[model samples]
Target: MTATVAIDSYFTPVPDEIEAIDLVVEGALPPELNGRYLRNGPNPKPGAPPAHPFVEPGMVHGVRLKDGAALWYRNRWVRTSLFTESATRVRPDGSLDLAACHANTHVIEHAGRTFALVESGLPYELSLDLDTVGPCDFQGRLTTAMTAHPKADPVTGDLHFFGYGVRPPFLTYHRLSASGELVQSVPVEVPGPTMMHDFAITEDYLVWMDLPVVFERTELGVPYRWSDSYGARLGLMPRKGGPVRWFEIEPCYVFHVGNARQDAAGRVVLDAVRYDRATFRNEWDLAAGKEKTGSVPGQMLHRWTLDPRTGVRSEQQLDDWSLEFPTLNENLVGLQNRFLYLVGGGSVVKFDTVNGERGVHRLPDGAKPGEAVFVPAENARAEDDGWLLTIVSNRIAGTADLLVLDATDVAARPVATVHLPRWVPSGFHGSWVPESVVR
Candidate 1:
């Protein structure tokens, strides 16, 4: 047999992106927030290798599929083999293993081909041949930190990922080759070493929130912390390198980093959710006025825009509800380009930002919407004719199904449903991984 290339062993450092910036935003975490649990959960121990089952379908929490498959990333708690055995629920004989679950998402594209996946908490790129159940790692660790919520640029086809890290704390980045190799990586500078909660990137820039506070491992072995600001500020970085501009979000704790979209006016508008004083809480049993925990009742959407030319930012409040996860389907843009979308609390509302009004569309009763994938009407119409893909799980059903809805009419109903054989727990992040893009 011919010798295989030792990609992982070769360590040639490549200079990274042209522009980058760290921004501090105002935001505090309540006990109930998702990040707190990852740090302070009872189990910190890693687990065994994952078992890729033939029948047990996969679902990603914070990832979306561009073609039809979803990029699912698991934490350390749910062991991989366990994920294979009892996908929908925990088994009595099943033990929880963190290591097996702590992996990036892999794509099993058509014709038994497997594409590599790069995710947080991993040192190197993950090359998974799902058909043969073989896995490989690329050279040098791309991220020593646990990256969170990576979004793929539909146009550039680059995977943009960001998240929390330690060791004087830093943000890490790796630009992957089409073959899924770690072509470049470097220490990405963020303002204040603030824990980057989540980030979204479009063709132009990377938008994220930096909360000031190093995460501490709780006595119970759970990682947790209290941010300096009840809210964090928003910042922007060109896909390249430069001085990062940090923007302050007034009157609200901009805890969660949402979507960054550009309007017809060439202005960039960032859509996110902020938990005010009433909605913020604390936990960790830490003393000295630090007993805040649990999320408040309602959540709202806040939009901020910056002039591309002058870098001047203008802010506005878009909509208020129990609104959590916000997605804008800018498939068509005209004077009346309607943004077809949905919220975390389960309302499908269309917003005409140009007009400044909202049209509400409700999902089928009892269908809980998680992170939704908006297949622009243009893309959806070309391949699948026209259908929006979404993963919805019902408590009673104990399963997550890939549901497709008509992009034009949110109230129309699901066009097709691919029932996932396993139960994917209520998760925080997810994305759409299209098959055509993967090699």
Candidate 2:
């Protein structure tokens, strides 16, 4: 007999596509809020769940706002070869079909195109209306899996991203011109295959995390595990593609990076959520719905300052509480940023890194908030001048709400709460595409 693995609370999937028009708003919507708020996450088939939650099929939930009204809401499952085919098939070369991607991790817009992304496969293109446009190979130039988290430079409008695989040539870097052309792809040298989910970019260099979580054969569903033999380090590579300078750091895992910038002294500063080896394994098991083993460690807000001249790295914990899904002003990517927004521990928090002050907006009892996305106000003066948008799951009510809070005052009452029709399962990352980009 086999023990049962319980499905995570967030694994529940909606039965069918849904559209709601003229949703009722609890408060006033920002008059300048004109755009779409889209989030992507896993939604497995009704009877056939994937071996791991991360590999499940993707569903995108979106809301359109214009003229200070909730114009519409729609949810659609991304159509890919994986979801359409009756049987799993492999190419003649034995490589998995990139078209058969889950595309469940994130939805982003670049080069006038919207893409649904899963780090292990190619990105599926989608129209502004939230309709799947099928797999895209960037004009047949992208041959590797695309990272779900791609950073668009605020100044140059270029997109900087990378892909990591379980095979050799394990890491590759890609860059797209502001005009949306795949202009560069360079193979990055690393010791072994590690789970490189997210990376950061500074004005002068790219920051890569080569952690200890390596691929291993296993009888269980997810084959990747933390290895004591594999060491942890960070790589600094130039934008023009050259030899990478590696810096050794303490063994830990970083799933997301808040932001990175180069200080006046040319030192690289990175802020992220860091988890120790023990905490990472336990959290991964819990997310896979495996039985509880040891206690899970909290994801701490940490900062690393790397001095290239001295070849030394200094790390510090900025906050003691558990948090994840960190976001900052998109315009501040690769630049100095004052506030970092994150969701977890039943609240939306705003951390002032310079002042060491934190503000939290607590949700209703038994309710949880997803990632908080920042939308800058029209004619924005300050970095924090915007509204924070997120889906709040009301477990007690069996529904969800699109809560909008003032970015500068997160602890204040929500400026608006647009009711959602169903419970949204907890998923990964998402993006806010302004109407200017849509048209």
Among these predictions, the greatest TM-score belongs to: 2
Q: After superposition, how far is residue 46 of candidate 2 from its true place, in Å?
A: 1.0
lDDT tens readout by residue for model 1, 35-150: 10011011112242222121112222222232333223222222233234433222367632212233333322212233222222332222221222322334444435334445
Model 2 spans > 4 angstroms off: 1-8, 86-89
Candidate 2 contains a number of clashing pairs equal to 0
lDDT for predicted candidate 1 compared with the true structure: 0.43
* Clashing pairs for predicted structure model 2, backbone only: none
Reference-based TM-score, model 2: 0.96
How high is the lDDT of residue 339 in model 2?
Answer: 95
TM-score of each: 0.61, 0.96
- Residue-pair clashes per candidate: 53, 0
Give the whole-model CA lDDT for all candidates, comma-separated: 0.43, 0.87
The TM-score between candidate 1 and the true structure equals: 0.61
